[model samples]
Target: MILDVSALLSGKVDVLEFDYIIPLLDEEGEATILPPPDVDFTSGIHICGRITDNAGYMALKASCEIGYRTACARCLTDLEGTFCYEFEKIAAKAGTIEGDEDNYVMITEGRLDLDRDVAEEVSLEFPTRFLCSEECLGLCPKCGKNRNLEPCDCANQKEIDPRLAILQKLLENQ
Candidate 1:
Protein backbone atom coordinates (compact mmCIF):
# COMPACT_ATOMS: atom_id res chain seq x y z
CA MET A 1 0.00 0.00 0.00
CA ILE A 2 1.14 3.50 -0.82
CA LEU A 3 0.33 6.42 1.46
CA ASP A 4 0.27 9.91 0.03
CA VAL A 5 1.80 12.31 2.55
CA SER A 6 1.54 15.37 0.36
CA ALA A 7 -1.00 16.99 2.65
CA LEU A 8 1.18 16.45 5.68
CA LEU A 9 4.24 17.52 3.79
CA SER A 10 2.53 20.69 2.62
CA GLY A 11 1.23 21.44 6.12
CA LYS A 12 -2.36 21.23 4.94
CA VAL A 13 -3.17 18.29 7.28
CA ASP A 14 -1.54 17.81 10.60
CA VAL A 15 -2.57 14.19 10.99
CA LEU A 16 -3.89 11.41 8.79
CA GLU A 17 -5.69 8.31 9.98
CA PHE A 18 -5.11 5.25 7.89
CA ASP A 19 -6.57 1.75 7.81
CA TYR A 20 -5.58 -0.64 5.08
CA ILE A 21 -5.01 -4.27 4.18
CA ILE A 22 -1.69 -5.58 2.93
CA PRO A 23 -1.91 -8.73 0.86
CA LEU A 24 0.55 -11.46 1.80
CA LEU A 25 0.45 -13.28 -1.50
CA ASP A 26 -0.40 -12.59 -5.13
CA GLU A 27 -4.13 -12.58 -5.73
CA GLU A 28 -3.86 -15.06 -8.60
CA GLY A 29 -1.48 -17.54 -7.02
CA GLU A 30 -0.80 -19.34 -3.73
CA ALA A 31 2.84 -18.35 -3.35
CA THR A 32 3.81 -15.86 -0.70
CA ILE A 33 4.95 -12.44 -1.87
CA LEU A 34 7.30 -11.23 0.88
CA PRO A 35 7.57 -12.99 4.24
CA PRO A 36 10.14 -14.44 6.62
CA PRO A 37 11.64 -17.79 5.64
CA ASP A 38 9.44 -20.88 6.13
CA VAL A 39 6.46 -18.73 7.05
CA ASP A 40 3.17 -18.96 5.18
CA PHE A 41 0.95 -15.97 5.68
CA THR A 42 -2.59 -17.27 5.72
CA SER A 43 -4.33 -13.89 5.67
CA GLY A 44 -3.86 -10.27 4.71
CA ILE A 45 -2.30 -7.97 7.24
CA HIS A 46 -4.69 -5.53 8.91
CA ILE A 47 -3.11 -2.20 9.75
CA CYS A 48 -4.57 0.72 11.60
CA GLY A 49 -2.63 3.79 12.56
CA ARG A 50 -2.12 7.47 12.18
CA ILE A 51 0.56 9.71 10.79
CA THR A 52 1.28 13.13 12.15
CA ASP A 53 3.57 15.93 11.08
CA ASN A 54 6.16 16.64 13.71
CA ALA A 55 7.82 19.95 12.93
CA GLY A 56 8.01 19.23 9.16
CA TYR A 57 8.87 15.54 9.69
CA MET A 58 6.30 12.80 9.37
CA ALA A 59 5.87 10.51 12.40
CA LEU A 60 3.96 7.26 12.12
CA LYS A 61 2.46 4.91 14.67
CA ALA A 62 0.77 1.70 13.58
CA SER A 63 -0.37 -1.72 14.77
CA CYS A 64 -0.81 -4.72 12.53
CA GLU A 65 -1.67 -8.42 12.68
CA ILE A 66 -1.64 -11.40 10.34
CA GLY A 67 -2.23 -15.12 10.61
CA TYR A 68 0.78 -17.28 9.81
CA ARG A 69 1.82 -20.93 9.60
CA THR A 70 5.29 -22.32 10.21
CA ALA A 71 7.09 -25.42 11.39
CA CYS A 72 8.58 -26.22 14.77
CA ALA A 73 12.33 -25.80 14.63
CA ARG A 74 13.05 -28.79 16.86
CA CYS A 75 10.41 -31.36 15.93
CA LEU A 76 9.34 -30.00 12.54
CA THR A 77 5.66 -30.08 13.40
CA ASP A 78 3.33 -27.67 11.66
CA LEU A 79 2.33 -24.76 13.87
CA GLU A 80 -0.03 -21.84 13.45
CA GLY A 81 0.35 -18.43 15.06
CA THR A 82 -0.40 -14.75 14.62
CA PHE A 83 2.16 -12.09 13.90
CA CYS A 84 1.33 -8.85 15.65
CA TYR A 85 3.24 -5.75 16.61
CA GLU A 86 3.03 -2.01 17.12
CA PHE A 87 5.64 0.20 15.49
CA GLU A 88 6.69 3.81 15.36
CA LYS A 89 8.85 5.47 12.75
CA ILE A 90 9.90 8.90 11.66
CA ALA A 91 10.07 9.55 7.93
CA ALA A 92 11.76 12.46 6.32
CA LYS A 93 11.81 13.65 2.74
CA ALA A 94 14.44 11.75 0.79
CA GLY A 95 17.97 12.88 1.63
CA THR A 96 16.83 14.94 4.58
CA ILE A 97 17.75 12.56 7.39
CA GLU A 98 21.27 11.30 8.01
CA GLY A 99 23.13 8.57 9.96
CA ASP A 100 21.27 5.37 10.85
CA GLU A 101 19.01 4.11 8.04
CA ASP A 102 16.89 2.03 10.38
CA ASN A 103 15.76 4.98 12.49
CA TYR A 104 13.50 6.30 9.74
CA VAL A 105 12.35 5.84 6.20
CA MET A 106 12.89 8.08 3.20
CA ILE A 107 9.83 9.46 1.50
CA THR A 108 9.98 9.95 -2.27
CA GLU A 109 7.66 12.05 -4.34
CA GLY A 110 5.59 12.90 -1.26
CA ARG A 111 4.56 9.26 -0.91
CA LEU A 112 5.55 6.49 1.47
CA ASP A 113 5.55 2.91 0.26
CA LEU A 114 4.30 0.75 3.12
CA ASP A 115 4.97 -2.61 1.49
CA ARG A 116 8.65 -2.70 2.33
CA ASP A 117 8.17 -1.36 5.80
CA VAL A 118 5.45 -3.87 6.60
CA ALA A 119 7.52 -6.77 5.33
CA GLU A 120 10.53 -5.68 7.34
CA GLU A 121 8.55 -5.19 10.50
CA VAL A 122 6.95 -8.60 10.13
CA SER A 123 10.31 -10.22 9.62
CA LEU A 124 11.75 -8.50 12.65
CA GLU A 125 8.82 -9.59 14.76
CA PHE A 126 8.96 -13.24 13.62
CA PRO A 127 10.61 -15.63 16.06
CA THR A 128 14.05 -16.88 15.05
CA ARG A 129 13.22 -20.37 16.35
CA PHE A 130 9.84 -22.01 16.64
CA LEU A 131 8.78 -24.78 19.01
CA CYS A 132 5.54 -26.72 19.15
CA SER A 133 5.72 -26.53 22.93
CA GLU A 134 8.12 -25.48 25.63
CA GLU A 135 8.88 -29.08 26.61
CA CYS A 136 9.14 -30.61 23.15
CA LEU A 137 11.31 -33.75 23.19
CA GLY A 138 12.74 -33.03 19.75
CA LEU A 139 14.42 -35.62 17.51
CA CYS A 140 16.97 -38.33 18.37
CA PRO A 141 20.43 -37.64 16.90
CA LYS A 142 21.51 -41.31 16.70
CA CYS A 143 18.51 -42.78 14.84
CA GLY A 144 16.93 -39.55 13.53
CA LYS A 145 13.55 -40.24 15.04
CA ASN A 146 11.02 -38.03 16.78
CA ARG A 147 11.49 -38.81 20.46
CA ASN A 148 8.17 -37.35 21.44
CA LEU A 149 6.20 -39.96 19.55
CA GLU A 150 8.09 -43.15 20.37
CA PRO A 151 11.14 -44.58 22.12
CA CYS A 152 14.27 -45.59 20.18
CA ASP A 153 16.79 -48.34 20.93
CA CYS A 154 19.63 -45.97 20.20
CA ALA A 155 18.82 -44.16 23.47
CA ASN A 156 20.09 -47.20 25.43
CA GLN A 157 23.51 -47.25 23.73
CA LYS A 158 26.46 -45.56 25.44
CA GLU A 159 28.25 -42.99 23.29
CA ILE A 160 32.02 -42.62 23.80
CA ASP A 161 34.00 -39.60 22.74
CA PRO A 162 36.65 -40.50 20.16
CA ARG A 163 39.16 -38.20 21.84
CA LEU A 164 39.13 -40.44 24.99
CA ALA A 165 40.16 -43.63 23.12
CA ILE A 166 43.80 -43.37 24.38
CA LEU A 167 42.61 -43.20 27.99
CA GLN A 168 40.40 -46.26 27.46
CA LYS A 169 43.43 -48.23 26.12
CA LEU A 170 45.56 -47.11 29.12
CA LEU A 171 42.88 -48.27 31.55
CA GLU A 172 42.57 -51.66 29.77
CA ASN A 173 46.33 -52.26 30.11
CA GLN A 174 46.16 -51.64 33.88
Candidate 2:
Protein backbone atom coordinates (compact mmCIF):
# COMPACT_ATOMS: atom_id res chain seq x y z
CA MET A 1 0.00 0.00 0.00
CA ILE A 2 1.21 3.50 -0.81
CA LEU A 3 0.33 6.62 1.14
CA ASP A 4 0.74 10.15 -0.16
CA VAL A 5 2.12 12.23 2.69
CA SER A 6 2.36 15.51 0.82
CA ALA A 7 -0.02 17.23 3.21
CA LEU A 8 1.78 15.87 6.24
CA LEU A 9 5.12 16.87 4.77
CA SER A 10 3.89 20.36 4.06
CA GLY A 11 2.48 20.76 7.59
CA LYS A 12 -1.05 21.07 6.26
CA VAL A 13 -2.38 17.81 7.83
CA ASP A 14 -0.92 16.84 11.16
CA VAL A 15 -2.36 13.35 11.13
CA LEU A 16 -3.85 10.97 8.57
CA GLU A 17 -5.69 7.66 8.85
CA PHE A 18 -4.96 4.76 6.54
CA ASP A 19 -6.70 1.41 6.06
CA TYR A 20 -6.17 -1.23 3.40
CA ILE A 21 -5.36 -4.89 2.72
CA ILE A 22 -2.16 -6.30 1.25
CA PRO A 23 -1.83 -9.66 -0.42
CA LEU A 24 0.95 -11.87 0.84
CA LEU A 25 2.93 -14.06 -1.50
CA ASP A 26 6.01 -16.19 -1.43
CA GLU A 27 8.95 -15.90 -3.84
CA GLU A 28 7.22 -18.51 -6.01
CA GLY A 29 4.17 -16.24 -6.37
CA GLU A 30 2.04 -18.58 -4.31
CA ALA A 31 -0.07 -17.59 -1.33
CA THR A 32 2.05 -17.94 1.77
CA ILE A 33 1.29 -18.72 5.39
CA LEU A 34 1.01 -15.03 6.10
CA PRO A 35 -2.21 -14.76 4.13
CA PRO A 36 -2.52 -18.51 3.74
CA PRO A 37 -4.29 -19.99 0.71
CA ASP A 38 -7.78 -19.66 2.13
CA VAL A 39 -7.77 -16.03 3.22
CA ASP A 40 -8.52 -13.45 0.56
CA PHE A 41 -6.15 -10.52 0.47
CA THR A 42 -6.77 -9.41 -3.10
CA SER A 43 -8.40 -6.28 -1.71
CA GLY A 44 -5.02 -5.11 -0.42
CA ILE A 45 -3.65 -4.82 3.13
CA HIS A 46 -6.18 -4.32 5.93
CA ILE A 47 -4.37 -1.64 7.83
CA CYS A 48 -5.50 1.23 10.03
CA GLY A 49 -2.92 3.67 11.26
CA ARG A 50 -2.55 7.24 12.29
CA ILE A 51 0.30 9.08 10.63
CA THR A 52 1.47 12.10 12.55
CA ASP A 53 4.18 14.65 11.97
CA ASN A 54 6.26 15.19 15.08
CA ALA A 55 8.36 18.27 14.54
CA GLY A 56 9.81 17.18 11.20
CA TYR A 57 9.63 13.39 11.58
CA MET A 58 6.66 11.32 10.51
CA ALA A 59 5.39 8.64 12.89
CA LEU A 60 2.97 5.90 11.98
CA LYS A 61 1.08 3.70 14.47
CA ALA A 62 -0.74 0.86 12.81
CA SER A 63 -2.43 -2.46 13.47
CA CYS A 64 -3.45 -5.22 11.04
CA GLU A 65 -4.91 -8.72 10.85
CA ILE A 66 -3.86 -11.37 8.34
CA GLY A 67 -5.56 -14.73 7.93
CA TYR A 68 -3.62 -17.74 6.76
CA ARG A 69 -3.75 -21.52 6.42
CA THR A 70 -1.14 -23.97 7.56
CA ALA A 71 -0.72 -27.63 8.19
CA CYS A 72 -0.73 -29.22 11.60
CA ALA A 73 2.90 -29.87 12.41
CA ARG A 74 2.14 -33.23 13.97
CA CYS A 75 -0.88 -34.54 12.02
CA LEU A 76 -0.35 -32.67 8.74
CA THR A 77 -3.98 -31.53 8.63
CA ASP A 78 -4.78 -28.20 7.04
CA LEU A 79 -5.69 -25.51 9.54
CA GLU A 80 -6.69 -21.88 9.28
CA GLY A 81 -5.42 -19.16 11.58
CA THR A 82 -5.11 -15.43 11.95
CA PHE A 83 -2.07 -13.27 12.68
CA CYS A 84 -2.35 -9.83 14.19
CA TYR A 85 0.37 -7.27 14.76
CA GLU A 86 0.79 -3.63 15.58
CA PHE A 87 3.78 -1.43 14.77
CA GLU A 88 5.00 2.07 15.27
CA LYS A 89 7.47 3.49 12.81
CA ILE A 90 9.23 6.81 12.49
CA ALA A 91 10.55 8.23 9.28
CA ALA A 92 12.44 11.30 8.28
CA LYS A 93 12.45 13.23 5.02
CA ALA A 94 15.06 11.41 2.97
CA GLY A 95 18.44 12.39 4.40
CA THR A 96 17.19 14.28 7.39
CA ILE A 97 17.37 11.40 9.90
CA GLU A 98 20.40 9.30 10.77
CA GLY A 99 21.36 6.57 13.24
CA ASP A 100 19.10 3.78 14.61
CA GLU A 101 18.46 2.31 11.22
CA ASP A 102 16.19 -0.28 12.78
CA ASN A 103 13.68 2.27 14.04
CA TYR A 104 13.50 4.65 11.11
CA VAL A 105 12.13 4.54 7.59
CA MET A 106 13.22 7.11 5.05
CA ILE A 107 10.38 8.82 3.23
CA THR A 108 11.32 10.07 -0.21
CA GLU A 109 9.18 12.18 -2.59
CA GLY A 110 6.50 12.50 0.12
CA ARG A 111 5.37 8.90 -0.28
CA LEU A 112 5.45 5.98 2.07
CA ASP A 113 5.33 2.43 0.73
CA LEU A 114 3.90 0.13 3.38
CA ASP A 115 4.15 -3.07 1.39
CA ARG A 116 7.44 -4.17 2.85
CA ASP A 117 6.55 -3.06 6.35
CA VAL A 118 3.22 -4.89 6.35
CA ALA A 119 4.80 -8.05 5.00
CA GLU A 120 7.46 -8.03 7.67
CA GLU A 121 4.94 -7.50 10.43
CA VAL A 122 2.78 -10.35 9.21
CA SER A 123 5.77 -12.65 8.95
CA LEU A 124 6.87 -11.77 12.43
CA GLU A 125 3.44 -12.72 13.75
CA PHE A 126 3.36 -16.08 11.98
CA PRO A 127 3.23 -19.12 14.22
CA THR A 128 6.28 -21.34 14.22
CA ARG A 129 4.16 -24.47 14.34
CA PHE A 130 0.52 -25.54 13.88
CA LEU A 131 -1.45 -28.20 15.73
CA CYS A 132 -4.90 -29.55 15.01
CA SER A 133 -5.47 -30.27 18.67
CA GLU A 134 -3.60 -30.21 21.94
CA GLU A 135 -3.65 -34.01 22.17
CA CYS A 136 -2.80 -34.80 18.56
CA LEU A 137 -1.47 -38.35 18.47
CA GLY A 138 0.70 -37.51 15.46
CA LEU A 139 1.95 -40.38 13.30
CA CYS A 140 3.51 -43.72 13.98
CA PRO A 141 7.24 -43.51 13.47
CA LYS A 142 7.69 -47.11 12.25
CA CYS A 143 4.59 -47.59 10.06
CA GLY A 144 4.07 -43.98 9.00
CA LYS A 145 0.43 -44.24 9.98
CA ASN A 146 -1.53 -41.42 11.53
CA ARG A 147 -2.08 -42.46 15.14
CA ASN A 148 -4.93 -40.06 15.49
CA LEU A 149 -7.02 -42.01 12.99
CA GLU A 150 -6.53 -45.46 14.53
CA PRO A 151 -4.24 -47.36 16.84
CA CYS A 152 -1.42 -49.26 15.19
CA ASP A 153 -0.12 -52.62 16.46
CA CYS A 154 3.50 -51.58 15.99
CA ALA A 155 5.53 -52.80 18.95
CA ASN A 156 5.72 -50.27 21.77
CA GLN A 157 9.08 -51.72 22.79
CA LYS A 158 11.75 -49.21 23.67
CA GLU A 159 15.06 -49.82 22.02
CA ILE A 160 18.03 -50.10 24.32
CA ASP A 161 20.47 -47.24 24.11
CA PRO A 162 23.60 -48.29 22.22
CA ARG A 163 25.81 -46.94 25.00
CA LEU A 164 24.06 -49.23 27.55
CA ALA A 165 24.03 -52.33 25.32
CA ILE A 166 27.57 -53.19 26.44
CA LEU A 167 26.34 -53.47 30.05
CA GLN A 168 23.54 -55.82 28.94
CA LYS A 169 26.05 -58.07 27.23
CA LEU A 170 28.31 -58.09 30.32
CA LEU A 171 25.35 -59.04 32.52
CA GLU A 172 24.35 -61.87 30.22
CA ASN A 173 27.93 -63.23 30.24
CA GLN A 174 28.13 -63.08 34.05
Candidate 3:
Protein backbone atom coordinates (compact mmCIF):
# COMPACT_ATOMS: atom_id res chain seq x y z
CA MET A 1 0.00 0.00 0.00
CA ILE A 2 1.14 3.56 -0.72
CA LEU A 3 0.99 5.85 2.33
CA ASP A 4 0.58 9.56 1.99
CA VAL A 5 3.09 11.48 4.06
CA SER A 6 1.88 14.95 3.11
CA ALA A 7 1.14 16.05 6.66
CA LEU A 8 4.41 14.75 8.02
CA LEU A 9 6.37 16.10 5.11
CA SER A 10 4.74 19.53 5.40
CA GLY A 11 5.53 19.78 9.12
CA LYS A 12 1.86 19.48 10.02
CA VAL A 13 2.50 16.17 11.79
CA ASP A 14 5.63 14.95 13.49
CA VAL A 15 4.94 11.23 13.18
CA LEU A 16 2.92 8.95 10.95
CA GLU A 17 1.81 5.50 12.11
CA PHE A 18 0.77 2.59 9.92
CA ASP A 19 -0.81 -0.76 10.75
CA TYR A 20 -2.02 -3.07 8.04
CA ILE A 21 -1.84 -6.47 6.41
CA ILE A 22 -0.31 -7.23 3.05
CA PRO A 23 -1.33 -10.22 0.96
CA LEU A 24 1.29 -12.78 0.10
CA LEU A 25 0.42 -12.50 -3.57
CA ASP A 26 1.97 -10.34 -6.20
CA GLU A 27 0.47 -7.74 -8.51
CA GLU A 28 -1.36 -10.49 -10.44
CA GLY A 29 -2.83 -12.12 -7.30
CA GLU A 30 -0.29 -14.95 -7.56
CA ALA A 31 2.79 -15.74 -5.52
CA THR A 32 6.21 -14.42 -6.51
CA ILE A 33 7.94 -16.56 -3.89
CA LEU A 34 6.60 -20.03 -3.23
CA PRO A 35 7.29 -22.05 -0.12
CA PRO A 36 7.45 -25.83 0.07
CA PRO A 37 4.22 -27.85 0.33
CA ASP A 38 4.78 -28.24 4.04
CA VAL A 39 4.86 -24.51 4.62
CA ASP A 40 1.58 -22.60 4.39
CA PHE A 41 1.44 -18.96 3.27
CA THR A 42 -2.29 -18.27 3.14
CA SER A 43 -2.55 -16.16 6.29
CA GLY A 44 -0.67 -13.24 4.78
CA ILE A 45 1.70 -10.89 6.60
CA HIS A 46 0.98 -8.28 9.27
CA ILE A 47 2.96 -5.04 9.46
CA CYS A 48 3.00 -2.28 12.06
CA GLY A 49 5.32 0.67 12.37
CA ARG A 50 5.79 4.41 12.55
CA ILE A 51 7.53 7.05 10.48
CA THR A 52 9.15 9.82 12.44
CA ASP A 53 10.10 13.08 10.83
CA ASN A 54 13.54 13.65 12.26
CA ALA A 55 13.63 17.32 11.34
CA GLY A 56 15.14 17.10 7.84
CA TYR A 57 14.53 13.37 7.14
CA MET A 58 12.02 10.70 8.05
CA ALA A 59 13.09 7.65 10.05
CA LEU A 60 11.03 4.58 9.26
CA LYS A 61 10.89 1.69 11.73
CA ALA A 62 8.67 -1.14 10.61
CA SER A 63 8.11 -4.76 11.58
CA CYS A 64 6.26 -7.57 9.82
CA GLU A 65 5.15 -10.97 11.08
CA ILE A 66 4.10 -13.95 9.01
CA GLY A 67 2.40 -17.13 10.12
CA TYR A 68 3.61 -20.38 8.62
CA ARG A 69 3.13 -24.11 8.76
CA THR A 70 6.64 -25.41 8.33
CA ALA A 71 8.38 -28.77 8.24
CA CYS A 72 11.77 -30.13 9.08
CA ALA A 73 14.09 -30.47 6.09
CA ARG A 74 15.43 -33.88 7.08
CA CYS A 75 12.46 -35.60 8.78
CA LEU A 76 9.53 -33.57 7.45
CA THR A 77 8.02 -32.93 10.84
CA ASP A 78 5.22 -30.39 10.78
CA LEU A 79 5.56 -27.13 12.73
CA GLU A 80 3.46 -24.02 13.30
CA GLY A 81 5.22 -20.76 13.97
CA THR A 82 5.40 -17.04 13.28
CA PHE A 83 8.44 -15.23 11.98
CA CYS A 84 9.09 -11.50 12.24
CA TYR A 85 11.34 -9.10 10.37
CA GLU A 86 12.30 -5.54 11.23
CA PHE A 87 13.07 -2.85 8.67
CA GLU A 88 14.55 0.61 9.16
CA LYS A 89 15.20 3.17 6.47
CA ILE A 90 15.85 6.87 6.06
CA ALA A 91 13.44 8.72 3.83
CA ALA A 92 14.00 12.03 2.12
CA LYS A 93 12.22 13.97 -0.57
CA ALA A 94 12.93 12.61 -4.02
CA GLY A 95 16.36 13.69 -5.31
CA THR A 96 17.25 15.28 -1.98
CA ILE A 97 19.56 12.55 -0.71
CA GLU A 98 23.04 12.41 -2.24
CA GLY A 99 25.74 9.76 -2.66
CA ASP A 100 24.72 6.46 -0.92
CA GLU A 101 21.18 6.55 -2.26
CA ASP A 102 20.92 2.78 -2.03
CA ASN A 103 20.73 2.92 1.77
CA TYR A 104 17.75 5.26 1.88
CA VAL A 105 14.14 5.09 0.72
CA MET A 106 13.44 8.26 -1.16
CA ILE A 107 9.90 9.55 -0.79
CA THR A 108 8.39 10.73 -4.01
CA GLU A 109 5.37 13.06 -4.09
CA GLY A 110 4.94 12.88 -0.32
CA ARG A 111 4.20 9.16 -0.37
CA LEU A 112 5.80 5.99 0.93
CA ASP A 113 5.32 2.62 -0.73
CA LEU A 114 6.53 -0.04 1.66
CA ASP A 115 5.10 -3.02 -0.16
CA ARG A 116 8.19 -3.67 -2.24
CA ASP A 117 10.59 -3.05 0.61
CA VAL A 118 8.72 -5.27 3.07
CA ALA A 119 8.37 -8.06 0.53
CA GLU A 120 12.06 -8.01 -0.24
CA GLU A 121 13.21 -7.98 3.39
CA VAL A 122 10.82 -10.74 4.41
CA SER A 123 11.70 -12.90 1.42
CA LEU A 124 15.39 -12.59 2.17
CA GLU A 125 14.82 -13.65 5.79
CA PHE A 126 12.65 -16.65 4.87
CA PRO A 127 13.90 -19.95 6.22
CA THR A 128 15.66 -22.16 3.72
CA ARG A 129 16.36 -24.94 6.21
CA PHE A 130 14.26 -26.23 9.11
CA LEU A 131 15.14 -28.83 11.73
CA CYS A 132 13.05 -30.67 14.28
CA SER A 133 15.86 -30.31 16.79
CA GLU A 134 19.52 -29.57 16.99
CA GLU A 135 20.46 -33.24 17.37
CA CYS A 136 18.16 -34.64 14.73
CA LEU A 137 19.20 -38.18 13.80
CA GLY A 138 17.79 -37.77 10.28
CA LEU A 139 17.17 -40.68 7.93
CA CYS A 140 19.33 -43.74 7.38
CA PRO A 141 21.14 -43.78 4.06
CA LYS A 142 21.15 -47.56 3.59
CA CYS A 143 17.65 -48.86 4.33
CA GLY A 144 15.85 -45.54 3.75
CA LYS A 145 14.49 -45.52 7.28
CA ASN A 146 14.16 -42.84 9.94
CA ARG A 147 16.87 -43.66 12.41
CA ASN A 148 15.20 -41.52 15.05
CA LEU A 149 11.99 -43.49 14.78
CA GLU A 150 13.54 -46.95 15.30
CA PRO A 151 16.86 -48.76 15.53
CA CYS A 152 18.39 -50.41 12.43
CA ASP A 153 20.67 -53.45 12.37
CA CYS A 154 22.53 -52.30 9.26
CA ALA A 155 26.33 -52.08 9.45
CA ASN A 156 27.47 -48.62 10.47
CA GLN A 157 31.22 -49.30 9.94
CA LYS A 158 33.27 -47.67 7.23
CA GLU A 159 35.08 -49.95 4.74
CA ILE A 160 38.90 -49.95 4.75
CA ASP A 161 41.18 -50.03 1.69
CA PRO A 162 41.77 -53.56 0.27
CA ARG A 163 45.56 -52.74 0.13
CA LEU A 164 45.61 -52.93 3.95
CA ALA A 165 44.51 -56.55 4.04
CA ILE A 166 47.99 -57.66 5.32
CA LEU A 167 47.73 -55.21 8.21
CA GLN A 168 44.30 -56.59 9.10
CA LYS A 169 45.74 -60.12 9.05
CA LEU A 170 48.64 -59.10 11.30
CA LEU A 171 46.30 -57.43 13.73
CA GLU A 172 44.06 -60.49 13.79
CA ASN A 173 47.08 -62.74 14.48
CA GLN A 174 48.16 -60.54 17.38
Measured against the true structure, the TM-scores of the candidates, in listed sequence, are 0.68, 0.66, 0.76
lDDT of 1 by residue, 1-174 (tens): 788988988989999888988776646665434667887778888888988887876788889888888988777889998878889888787897778878686789989877667767776786766788887766665555787798787646677455554544453343
Give each prediction's root-mean-square deviation over alpha carbons.
7.4, 8.1, 7.7
| Candidate 1, superposed: residue stretches over 4 Å from native | 26-33, 139-174
Judging by lDDT against the true structure, name the best candidate.
1
Q: Residues 83-162, candidate 2: write the lDDT tens digits.
A: 67788888666787667666766677989877776676666665677678988877655555788898886536578556
Off by over 4 Å in 3: 32-40, 153-174
- What lDDT, from 0 to 1, does candidate 1 have? 0.76
Model 2 lDDT vs. the true structure? 0.69
How big is the RMSD of model 1? 7.4
**Between candidates 2 and 3, which one is better according to lDDT?**
3
- 2 or 3, which is superior by TM-score? 3
Candidate 3 whole-model C-alpha lDDT, 0 to 1: 0.75
